[model samples]
Structure formats: C-alpha cells, structure tokens
Target: MPQSYVKRILNARIYDLAVETPLEDMPLISDRTKNNVIIKREDLQPVFSFKVRGAYNCLLQLTDEQRKGGVIAASAGNHAQGLALSAKHLGVNATIVMPRTTPMIKVEAVKRRGAKVVLHGDTYDEASEHAHSLVEEKGMTYIPPYDHPDVIAGQGTVAMELLRQHSGPIDAVFIPVGGGGLCAGMAAYIKYVRPEVKVYAVEPEDAACLKLAMDRKRRAVLPQVGIFADGVAVAQIGKETYRVLKDTIDGVITCSADEMCAAIKDIFEDTRSIAEPAGALSLAGLKKYVAENGVEGQTLVTINSGANTNFDRLRYISEQTEIGEQREAIFAVTIPEEPGSYKKFCSLLGKRSITEFNYRYADNRDAHIFVGMQILPGGNDRQEIVEKLQKHGYDVVDMTDNDIAKLHIRHMVGGHAPQVENEIVYRFEFPERPGALLQFLTKLAGRWNISMFHYRNHGSAYGRVLVGMQVPSKERKQLEALLSELNYGYSDETDNPAYQYFLS
Candidate 1:
C-alpha cells in the first residue's frame, strides 16, 4: 500500500494549480521545546490550503466527458474553496454545497471563485447528502473531499515536498486528521520512503474519529462532534483513507480546542500568520507529544494545514489561548464580605497579574469572587496558587477546567438571584444563523418564565448560550421533551459547580 502510493504521489500533476509550499523553521518553538521544530507552509497555497493539491489532482484524473458534465462537492469551507478554484482554472462548472452554519467569509469565497454555492443543513454530513443528490440528478461527477485514491495520492505530495525540501533526520511528522486523507497520504509516502521517521495523526479531542476507529479496529461514527475546529469536525474516518492510515501511521494524538487555540497563537507569534484551528492542530499535538515524552534535541515537523479562518474568530481564539497554554488560571474564591476583606485578599495575591476579577454581594457572611490570574506554564503553578490561597484561609475552588465556568459563568459572575425559585440552568449550542436565538426563545416563551439568559458570539459556526428557566418539578419532563424537540445540542448545568458558586 505504501509503495504504491509513493509512485502515485510522485506523478500527481498538482503543480499546475498548487505550488510547492515551503518547509520553514520555527526558531521560537524550537527554543521553547528544545527540538528543531519546523512547519510545512501549506497555508501559502493558491487556495490558502493543501486541499487544492488533492482537488486539482482529482480533477485531472477525470475523463473529458466527466469534466464537461462538471463536478460538485460538499465542504464546510477549505475544500469548497479548493475545488471551486481548481474547477475555475480548468474551465469546468463547479457546484458546492455548504452548511448554512458556515461562515459568510467562506461562502463568499466560493462564489468569488465562480462556483454555484448552495447553503443546506447545519452540518457537513447534511450538506454532503444534498451534494450527492445533486450529483445523481445532474449526472455530474462528485469530487469527494478526501475518501478517494486520487485525492489521497495528491495529498501525499505534501510528504514528497517535505522530504525533498529538508534532508535532515526528522524524528516525527504530525498531520491533522479530518476524514484521515492527509494523514493516510503522508503516512504512506513517508513510511515507504523513510520508514524510520514517525508519522502521528492529530485530531481535535471532540472529533477524534481516527482515534476512535483505531480503537474499534474498524470505521466508527461519533454520535456528536464539536465544531470549534470546524475544518476538521468529521464524525467518521473515510474508509479508503482509514485503510492506509491503520497500517501506515505510527500513532494518533488528540488535542483539546483550547490547545488548538494556543497553537494558533504560537503560529502567529512565530510566523506572524494566524492559522485556523484545524491548521494549527498538528502543532498542538506536536507540542503535547514533546511535553509528554520529554524528547529533547530532536527534529519535529507539523503541517500548517490552512489559513482560511474568518478574522472575527480571532477574538474568541485569543481569549482561550492563555488557558490552553496553561498561562492563566481561573478560580472562585470565598472571601469575607466585611470591609477591608477585598484588600486583604489582594495582599495575599501579591504582584501576580490579574486577568479578570468579578464580584457581587450575596450575603453578609462570605463573598465569592470570580477571579482569573496569570500563572507560569507547565500547569503546576495553578495548583500552587490554590494551595497558597487555601493556606491563607481563603476557600478556593479551581474553575480553570470547568466548562460552564469558562463558557458562561465567567461572564455571568454577578447573576445571583436566590429569590428566583425553580430556576434550572442549561447551556446550549445555538446555530449562528440570524433567527436562531429568536427561534429558541419563541419555543419556550409561553411555556416557561425565563429567569436568566446569556449569550456571546465566538465568531464560529455556533453561538454559546446559557439559559435559566423557572419550571416546577411537575413540568420538568415536559421541559426536557420540549428541549429534545428543539433539536439543538444542550446540557443541564443546574448543579454545575461554577453555576452553583456564582449564579445560583
């Protein structure tokens, strides 16, 4: 399998549309990790992604009859742009089906490339179903985003370029996995040519299809997947790509969304270029591997997959980077409600940088202050700070890893209303469409009294919402049924420690 892919990759003919991206050194990353860190600059491609290489190669393999009939594909963003540009260059008509939740930046980009853009469901899977139906109805060729052999072979060209560009002794190469195309392609080529160099597949923790498939020893589907790193939010590994990857790849590494955000910041600081979450995934995994294995003086490489992120998303990414890198810690501290208590707590904190501090009076006995403080990297300082506060008689609860706290409680720190009885808190993922919030509110308006509501746009495909409703115990099941009927992802946060400490 590996040997066969090496030949196909060498002959891929993608240079007509895709440039040979550079293998550049990251001096800052290298110094920090004690490894010779390097990045494959695929973000510099014509489509600002490595997808163009595969998309164009797939098109080149199509028959003249097929090209005349045109092509169609379903993609969240990157692949849509790649195929659109490739088809435009080949003078072929292209039709792209994208999720309605896709960012406007990406939708406009596809239209700008002369492709017919159709906004369908709120997920890639639904968009894909619609694209396949169009392909059947119009008798057009359906260019898969990743599953096909030609696509895999074309993606393998990245490894071909990487090895040729840098002839050094590389310890490992990390590739981000969505439907496993890039990982399978690169792993096959690398193992065939340089078997000694390790190939690791990286995926977002919430959408680790490859890791789940490896564990099951077969293709497995996730019931749900997080779309924070929307570019790689695949629920299942592609069949063909998985076949090659299962035998060729060394291992799989999964990373959190925060870690990916941190990697985005790292790429920006080192290369002065903002990488999309999926683009920075491999770097996030590389950093995790370095920290876990404690390997020093070794050569490591990661692919910066693409830079097609919306500029507005950077604000949300920036907010999470500090926590992702373990440079900041959040806590709910109980201090005295009496005068001079706030001053005493500040004296205990000394000169540490305070990232955020929110407080509201609840009672005369004690005060719970939501605080965020800068901490040294490596994750130990956060616990050390907690112990110091505890030793000083400050009852502290670490909210650094609390999802509710990070997502909502931090913003609603002073929203304590004890008088409001039967208040149940829920966190929901609201689609980013214009009427989504209003629709959500309308569904529950007459049935229940809304006690609290909070929402913040993270500039992704969805918005995070925290809602509190007044419902009697008798109507609890009815409320649950209504939420189910609403068909939006949500979680009960009524008893969540962060909400209990701050809002309840």
Candidate 2:
C-alpha cells in the first residue's frame, strides 16, 4: 500500500462508515469529452454521501464521557442525516438543528434517522448560532459540518480511496464546495500525499462563498443563496476549512444554474445516476475550467459527492438541457405580408423539429415573427440557416442557446400587432433541419410581410409552425398555390380567437 493508503489504515478506525465508495471510470462521459474522466461515486456511500465518514469519525473520537453527554449538529440537510445516523450507531443522543426553510423531505430524513430535530431561523447561519447556544447551555458536544482538523482528516478518506482504486495519476480533481469541508479535506490530503496533483473547488455562481473568500483573501459571506442547488447553497465557508483551502486548493470556479443542469443530464446519460445540482458542480466546473484553460488529454476525477436531489427538479432539467447546451435555437423573423406568405415561410425549415408554435393575425404592424426550435442533438449548422434567411432579405434574430431566450424570450412576445392591419394566421408542418427554414424564406417572394410567428424544435422528426402574415387579401390564391407546391401539412387559423387578441 502507498503512504496515502497507510494513512487511511491509521485513521480508518476513527470513522463509523459501513461501506467504502468505489471510483469507477465512466467510459461514456470520457468518450464524450475526449478525455479520461473518472467519477468517485461518493453518492453511493452508505450515507448517500461521504458526510458519514467525517460525521462518524468526529463522533467516534470523543471520549466515553463526552458520548454520555450527547452531541448536537447544524446542517441544511445531508450533514444532519449523517450525524443522526452516526449518533444512532454510536448509541449517543443527537440533536440536529436545521433552518426552518429546509425542504420537508430533508427534515423528515433527519428525523427518520433517529435524531431530535429542531427547526430554527430562516438560514443556516441562524440555525448554527442556535445550535451553538444549545451546546453551551446543555454541555452537549458540537459536531460541526467542517472547520475541524478531525473532520478534515476523515473526509480525506475519499482521496485515500481514489488513489487506491485508480490506476493512473490524476491530472486534476474537481470537488464541490459548501462549508468547504470536502474540498479542504481532499486538497490537504492530496497535496500531502501527491504534491503534483491539482485540486479545484467548484461552487454555484449565485452562492459562491468559497470563490468570493478566495478572491478577497478573507472569509466572505453572501447575503442570499440560490436554493436551486440546495446542498451547496451555503452563505459562508467555515474558518478552519478556508485555512486549508486558501493555499491547498489550486483554483476555485463558479458554474451557472443552466450549465449545472446540462452537466447533470450529461452525467445521467453516462452513469445513469441523477446528481443534485451541487453534485453536478464538480463536473460543470471541469468543463468550464477545461474550456477556459484549453486543457486537453488530462486524466480527471470529479467527486459525485451526493445525489439527494428532489425528483421535481428533473422536469426543469430536461426542459432546459438543450438550452443549457446551446443546442436549441430561437429566432424572430420578418416576412412580406400576404395571404399565402405563411406557407412559403414554412418551406424554409427543411427538417428541424418544432418544439413550440403560436401565431396571431388579427392586428398588424411591421411583420415581425418570433420562432423557437430545438436543433438536432449535436447539430452545429446555425450559420447555414442564417445565410438562407438572409438571402431572401428575411431579418432574423437568433436566440438559440441564449440564456435570455430560454428564460424570457421563448415564451414571451408573439402574434399580430394591434397597430398594424390585414394580418392573417397559418400553422404549417415544416421539416426540422438546420437550413430547412432558411430555404423557405429564400424561395418566398412579394412585398407581403410576416407579422407574427412561433416555432420551437423539440428534437423530433417533424416541425409544427405558427405564422402570421400581412398582405393584400387578393394574394391568398398565390399563397395557396405555394403551399400546394410545398407538399407539407398545413392549417389556416386566420379567424381564430387567439389571432384576434394577438393581432388586434
């Protein structure tokens, strides 16, 4: 065994963890990124996290007298459950103080593991303060989430496992940061054993307490944390953990909610495991850091710390995956107003699947249309579509993979303008492909303009389109003739009630 392995043996007796987690090389994800990426599946640990290793190790180190006195802990979720289970195994009384805003599932989980639960305050800081007061008032042992030498030693066991199970030297290790327990422990241990390996800490951009602290060269506190990634939504890093992290960790990076979601999906596709946003932070960090630094061909290991994620959040994850990866595109297009103009426009999208479609032809102004579509997975032909639309003088605003488009524009703004007149509505089935829409736009002729349109690709074989056109009623015959030539399905909603409100 190596020195790192020997250290684990000396310290193994201190932890109460029932099982050691495995480090498995993820071939699917490795191939996707064109690098050797291995995952330390801490999510599969007995506690569904490496938290048990530290929580139990800290408790076991206490003298018999301290055990008799009992113990207290503060956490938003995972640590609470870890301590609760550990105290139960040790036959010691444990009380967990959680913020009142903690999710019901987490609160129940802590209690289910046989710990007395006390809900206090709205944030973790307030709850931690209350826990401290209890410790002083009742003389109970306080088991902190991190910020202790013993905790760091115990959490370091994760690195112990990685070195033992992995065959190759790790180029980089990405770890998620909260109170900085995991990063601090892993960094200290890795540096002590393998001085050449690099350690990186990742945090949610909205709640990047560690990143902020590293930049300021002091402990920094955030006023609010985004609860989306609940596990790592900590406002401040622990003092002792920060001491180890400030110098031991090579760098700190922040990831956006969207990027994290995409990472989660990618990991799920590869490992068939659902990682919480916090758990996905390490993978997201690796992607961002690698891209920024142009790192390539490096063996990487990212800790999948915990997966205690809510299932409801998966819906949003699925919906935004394309948007997160920039595979979906949204556009605003303008066409000449005329009766058959809508059909001619649909011909432009050759094979792109439409995810959403809406149109209004009641009111009129300049023919401005909004459209959204999910391009085929891994498709990168956006410029080709733009060129086709530009050739026919169709002005388009591309919003694919744009945060502003997904969060705001995709569902907002469409239909006929009340200020304009002679608008008509038509819905068409267009092929969902990169240049399909552009070709239709190129073939369209005349002075008639497009008033409103909505189209989004859903990664399907066919596309559904909604378009509003402004043109003379006499041009209706010509538009029908063009539709007949296109040989695709069509629906005319020129008189629909929705057309009236949006167009009027």
Candidate 3:
C-alpha cells in the first residue's frame, strides 16, 4: 500500500503554488542535544503553512465541471487560507466556512485571497456541517481538510523534497499530527523509499487522537481536545489518514503544552522564526525523544509546520518556557510569621536566584509563601530543592506542575478570604468571541454570588476564566446542572493545592 503512493506523490501537481521547502540545520539545537538536528522549513511556504501543497494538488485533479462549480471547506485557519490561495491561482471560486472563534487574522487572510468567508459556529464540527449544506445547495465539491487520497499524495511531496535534499543517512523524521494528513503522507513516502529511516508522529498530549487510535487499533474520536495548539486540535484522526498512518508510522510521541511552548522558543533561537504552537510540535517530540532515550550522534529531522500564531500569545508562551525547559521551579513553603524568617529562608536557598516570591500575612503561627527559583534542566535539581526545604523543617509543595498555580494563583496570591463561605472554584474555557463573556456572566451570575474571578486572554481560540461562586451545599446539584447547560469546558478546582495554600 505504501508503494502505491510513490508515483502519485512524485506526480503531484503542486509546484505551481507550493515551493520546495529547504531542510536547514539547527546548529544550536544540534549542539545542545548532541545530534545533527535539521528542520524542514515548511513554515516558509507562501501561505506560511504546508497546507497549500495539498490544496493545490487536489484542485489540479478536479475536472473542469468541478472547477466551475467551485469548492467549499471548513477550517479553523490554515486550511482555509491554503484552499483560498490555491483556488485564486486556478481561477476557481472558493467558499470557506470558519468557526466564529477563529482569529480575525485568518478570516481576513482568506477574504484577501478572493474566497467567500462564512463565519459559522463556535467549533469546527459546526462549521463543517454548514459547509456541507452549502456544497449541496450550490452544487460545489466539498474539500476536506485532510481525508482525500489526492491531498495525501500532495502532502507526500514534502518527503520527496526532504529525501532528495538530504542524501545522507537520516535516523528518524518527526512529523506533527492533527487529522494525520501530513504524517500519513510523509510516513508513507519515507517508509516506501527508505524503510530503515523511522517515521514518528508527534501530537499534543491533550489532543493525541492519533496515539489513541493506534492504541485502540482503530480510529476513535475524543470527547474533547485542548486547543492551545489550535492548528492540531482535531478531535478525531481522518478516516483515510488513519488507514495509512497505522501501518507507516514507527511510533507516536505526545508533548505537553509547556513543552510545545519551549519548542517555540527553541525554534526562535535557532532560526529566528516564531512558530505557532502546532508548528513547533514535532520539534518538541524530537527533544523529548532525545532526552528520554539519551540519544546522541544521530541525524534527526522535523518540520516547522506553520508560523501563523497571534502576536499576543507570545507573552503566555514566554512565561511558560522556563518551566517547560525545566529551568524554573515553583513551590509553596510555609515559614514562621516573624521577624528574620524571610532572611533565614533566603539563607537556606543560598546562591540560587529567585524568579518569584509572593507572600501575604495569614496568621502569626505560620505563613505560606509562594516561591519560584531557577533550576538546572533535569528532574533531579527540582527534587533536590524540594527535599532541602523539607529537611529544614519547612513544609514544601511543588507548584511547578500545577496548572492553576502557574496560570492563575501566581498572579493572584493574596491572603485567604475567611469570611467567604460555601465557595466553589471552577476553571472554564469558552469560545473566545464577541459578547462571549457577557453571555457567560448573564447565564452564571444571576443564581450564584461571585466571590472571586480572574480572566486573562492568551489570544488563542478560547478564553480561560477562573471563578469562585458561593453555592450552598443543598444547591450544588443545581449549579452543576446549570454548568452542564452552559456547555463550556470546565473543571472544579476547589481541592487544588495551590488554592488551598494561597487563596482558599
């Protein structure tokens, strides 16, 4: 089956729109990881993503009648821009149905490419349904984001260029997976041409649809998926893509959000290019593989998939990079609330630099301090610091891996509100769109009295809000029902240790 795709990939008519992206060496990452590391510069494509290759190739196969009828697709961002640009080049009309939560920049980009942009529902599924309806009504062909043979063959061109560009031996290739189109295509080509070179698929930890599918030995849909790497936040691997990838891919690696952020920084340092979280996903997996296996002196390659990230998200990415790189450790330590206690604590820390120190008076007997310090890149250093503090008779709780602590508590470390009773804390992520906050407040505020609230914009597809509301025990079920009706992703955090230490 893999052999069957070789000719189609070689003959894919994408050169008119898609350039042959270069394979560039990452000198800094190569030296740091002790491997000859290189990256496929797919991010440098005209559409700033490799999606154009498949979009154009698929369009080239369309019959003259299909071209006259045009094409329709539902995409969060990249795919829409790709199809729009491709259609413009071929003189075919395109209709793109995008989620309302899609960033303005992408919507405008599609419009500028002469595509009719339809702002549909909050999620891709909703927009996709609307797109299908339009396809029937307008008698247009439906262009799936990543499920067709033509598209897969088109994406395989990346591998064709990669192997041709680098004739030297390559140990492995890392490709990021969303609906698995790029991974499936690339893996098929690589396995067919060079069976010894392993192909690994990379996915976000919270959006590991391909990994789950591989484990289950069948395609499975995720109930929900995290959208931090919005480009690859697909809840299900495509039917056709899963078919090819299940056989061709050597393994799957999933990385956390923090790890992806660190990879973004890594790409920036090596190439001076800012990659979107999904764009840097393969590099994150490559780093994890090298560290976990203690691998060295091998040639590794990964693709920089895209570079269409919103500028505002860089702040959040920068904040998490230190922790992602294991260069920062955060903890909650209790000390006596008396004179010279701070000095004593500092003395114990010795020469280590403190990244953050937040404390507020709670009682005379003991005081809880939220502290952050620089640490070496390994698990051992963080553990040593924790053990040292505990050995000094100080109660220490590691907050470095705590989501609430890093995202909210670090910015809201104030004394506990003793007077607030029956308070329940919940973290919620809702579609980030106009009047979304107002709608959320209108539905949630009337029944329960708000005790605490914190909201920050990371400029992704969703808005995260932490809310503490006072609901009596008897009315807890009512609150749950209301939350279910609200239809937002939420998690109760009342028992979170970060909140227990600083803001309960």
Candidate 3, superposed: residue stretches over 4 Å from native: none
The Cα error of candidate 1 at residue 446, in Å, is 1.5
Local distance difference test, each candidate: 0.92, 0.75, 0.93
Clashes of each: 0, 41, 0
Residues 290-353, candidate 3, lDDT per residue (tens digit)?
9999999999999999998999999999999999998999999999999999999999999999
Per-residue lDDT of 438 in model 1 = 80
Tell me the tens digit of each residue's lDDT in model 2 across 476-496. 888887867776566687764
Of models 1 and 3, which has the larger lDDT? 3
| lDDT by residue for model 1 (1-504), tens | 899888889999888789999999999989999999999999999889999988999999999999999999999778899999999999999999998988888999999999999999987779999999999899999999899999999899999999999997999999999997888889999999999999999999999999999999999999999888887989999999999999998899999988999999999989999899999999999999999999999999999999988888888799899999999999999999999998899888899999999999899999999999999999589889999999999999998888788878887889889899999999999988879988888888789888999987777888889999999999999999989988999999999989889888
Minimum summed lDDT over a 10-residue window in model 3 is located at 436-445
Off by more than 4 A, model 1:
none
RMSD of each: 1.0, 14.2, 1.0
In candidate 2, which residue ranges exceed 4 Å CA deviation?
Answer: 1-18, 332-346, 360-362, 366-370, 375-504
Error of 2 at 215 (Å): 1.8
